[model samples]
Target: MQSTATSIKAYLEEIPEERKIAFTKLRETILENIPKGFVEQMSYGMIGYVVPHSIYPDGYHCEPKLPLPFMGIASQKNFIALYHMGIYANPELLNWFVTEYPKHSTQKLDMGKSCIRFKKMNQIPFELIAALVQKMSVQEWIICYESAFKK
Candidate 1:
């Protein structure tokens, strides 16, 4: 998720009316399942979930000025996107998701390396998304990220 919304509220407000409901529902699902110590804020011009600098002093490796980004949700021109860094870093998790997404719905899964793009509201798998989010903790994500830094 990347864009110029100064705040999450601003980010939400900028979403087109057609996307707000889906984004809002996904936002609620994310908020409900996010691990402790992760905070929601505007990042890269979108609504991002991050480990704050206060929790992890080093911040983002590529941009230490920013927090450690875990996930993000953005409404693109063609679809709504969910960026899951945890899945991107963990191949097993990605494989599991790719295998299981179809079980949640019949719609085709459209995804990028770390982005799950929903072309329709019904294409969003709320329970599956919630389950995926719940699988990672802040500590787990930090450890995974740190290990990546070593290589």
Candidate 2:
């Protein structure tokens, strides 16, 4: 069976008919707002945009196969998550997010690993999240990504 669709563009099209509109809007918001260097692709069954390892050749000392980029998005059973590696990667960013968005109680936000899970598109802060993505350097993002998978 096909686990994950190959490209982000195709994954969006594959969303169930009922959820297409919502997912598409979310996808558009992400595409329109993220920094220029980022590129979108389908990863783990959802739409993900990454900086690609090529941009940061010297990023991670180990786990060279994984890309050096810093962000991802996935469609889960209940919600679509906009995984911001930048927010979870930096302590300062994590603190700011928790303080600024107190209402995100049910959703999970982890600075140590940087992922924001939302049941719906409305639950996310588009501008702030976009800005966070904008702020991360490819190298900084790679450090964060490496930290998460490290044992």
lDDT of each: 0.89, 0.61
Per-residue C-alpha lDDT of model 2 across residues 38-85, encoded as one tens digit per residue: 667654455667666668555334555644445676666666666676
TM-score for candidate 2, residues paired by index: 0.71
Which regions of candidate 2 deviate over 4 angstroms?
Answer: 58-63, 103-112, 139-151
TM-scores for candidates 1 onward, in order: 0.95, 0.71
What digit string (tens of lDDT, one per residue) describes model 1 on residues 8-103? 877788899988888899999999999899999888877899999999988999988999999998998889999999888988889999998989
Regions of candidate 1 where Cα sits further than 4 Å from its true position: none
Give the lowest summed-lDDT range of ten residues in model 2. 103-112
Q: Report the number of the highest-TM-score candidate.
A: 1
